[model samples]
Target: MTRHPVLEARNLRLQFGGVTAADDASLSIAAGERVAIIGPNGAGKTTFVNICTGYLKPQSGSVRFEGREITGVTPREIVRNGIGRSFQLPQLFLDTTVLDNLLLALAAREGIWNTWTPLKRHPRRDEMLDLLEVIGLTETAHQLPRELPEGMRKLVDIAMALALRPRLIFMNEPTSGVSTREKFAIMDVVIRALQHNATTAVFVEHDMEVVSRYADRVAVWSFGRIGLEGTPAEVLNDPDVRRGVVGS
Candidate 1:
């Protein structure tokens, strides 16, 4: 039997002012796979994500989710299509409580806005709270984003993405700006939590330790294209991957 890819990008190309952000990049991730996209800065890692999540349109290429081509779909529509994404910098409602941030995400997914006031009695509130616990932020659920540490803030942002009940998620630099000491701790909790939820994850990360720990597969991007793809050990240990793409 042929296994269908849950996420697939084919010959993707994107350019901004003569700078190619994504150039003919292509890769496929099966359902339940945890893949890491890694490279140094300007590797077009984030740009690849932007195109995948519909935040940026490629000049030419195709993005397919579960057999359906979704090229050029709007971000909102992309979320509706069962793919969620998190930004590099934790994007959160700074003044909103952790619970409120998730609640807003739920409401947005359901497309129910009062226009004059917040809706009460969302059936998914309890579900959202459960997600908070999974992300290890249940104790601070009532606190505002500003009151939480950087790691917790990232958790909240991920929880918001999970609130949408996506089948696959694209996370951009999940550990960026976190204290070095907290990096592994945060990742352990996040990966374990997502596994418990049966969520498929793809993240762009710089930390090789974190990537080695969490990624089932690794894709190395360089010069705005995919340079290597294999298991973590396979890809990371490849001399070409090390000296040419990652080390460059």
Candidate 2:
């Protein structure tokens, strides 16, 4: 028996004025797969992810999750339907402690806003703490996002997305603003957390090494389309990809 893909996008097309963001774009992601979308800037990688997560609506085509259409759903509807995403830039309440950041995420997941309860006293405090521990951010739990380094801030943003308990998560540029030495370590923590939660990952990445080390497969986005999809070695080593994407 053939299992339906967990997420499917079919011939998605989107445009902004004269710029084409997605042009006949389509892809399918299976459960448990770590898929990487790699390309140069403005190649439609982030645009596709935005469409899937409902942050941007496509001009045409459809996005389906678990065999149900969700192209026209709102972002919150997509989240409730088990899809979540983190942005290229870290999005967090910089004034709040990391723990409170996650506590708020947990509350949002349950649609429990407007509570006067303190974060420390939230019902899911322990669960948020465990999530922090899983992502190697336990020690920074009490630190504000402004106090932590960029890498830690990225992880906190991702953890907040995870708190929503998504079946599939899209991470846009998961390793964009970090020291070279810390990129691998950051990805190690993020990937392990995704695995622990049994979530499928689809990340947009510019770093070929990150894609090589972490992705089960890769899709090369070029000029608003995926020109190739293969294993890391296969995609990264292709002559066209090396010339077009890697610019080598």
Candidate 3:
């Protein structure tokens, strides 16, 4: 028997004025696979992620999740179809406590947006607390985003995405904006949480170390298309990737 890919894009094309963001882009991600998208800046990695996750409408092509076409769907519809994504910047409520931020996410997942309701009494409060613990932010749950370090903020964003109980999650530069000393630590926590939930992940990352350590497969984008797709060793060590992507 054949298992279908969790997400698949075929012959995607997108453009902005004179710039072609995606050109004949195609890929498939199986369930539970950790796929990394890496490329030089402006190579359209983020654009492709946006298109796949329904944040951008491609000029042409199709996207399928679990064998059903989802191209041109709304972002919220995609989320409802079991896709979640975190941005390069932490998309958090800066004024709210970490716990409140997650509680809000849980509420959004449940289609409850009554902001007047007491979050502490929400039916899913315990689930939100468990997510905080999973992200290693239990002790700082009451702290505002401003009080938390960059790494913790990133984790909280990821937690909010996870609260949706997505089958596949896209993380755009999860390690960006954090100190080098904290990158691995942040990744460790994020990866552990993903594993605990048995979620499939696709991440856009610039750090070769992060890709090497965490990716099950890698796709390198160049000239608005996938130039290489293989294991970390195959993609990272390719002469073209070193020169074109790594700039070595």
**Alpha-carbon TM-score of each model against the true structure:** 0.93, 0.96, 0.96
lDDT of 1 by residue, 51-152 (tens): 989999999999999988899899988999999888888999987788888889989887765576554467668887788877778899889899988888
lDDT of 2 at 73: 85
Give the alpha carbon lDDT tens digit for every residue of 33-97 in model 3.
99999999999999999998899999999999988899999999999999999989899999889
lDDT of 2 at 198: 95
User: What is the per-residue lDDT of model 2 for residues 66-109, given as tens digits with 9 covering 90 to 100?
Assistant: 99999978999999999988989999998889999998899888
Which residue runs does candidate 2 get wrong by more than 4 Å?
1-3, 113-116
Q: Specify the poorest-scoring 10-residue window by lDDT in model 1.
A: 112-121
lDDT (0-100) at residue 81 of candidate 3? 93
Residue-level error in angstroms, candidate 2, position 178: 0.7
Clashes of each: 0, 0, 0
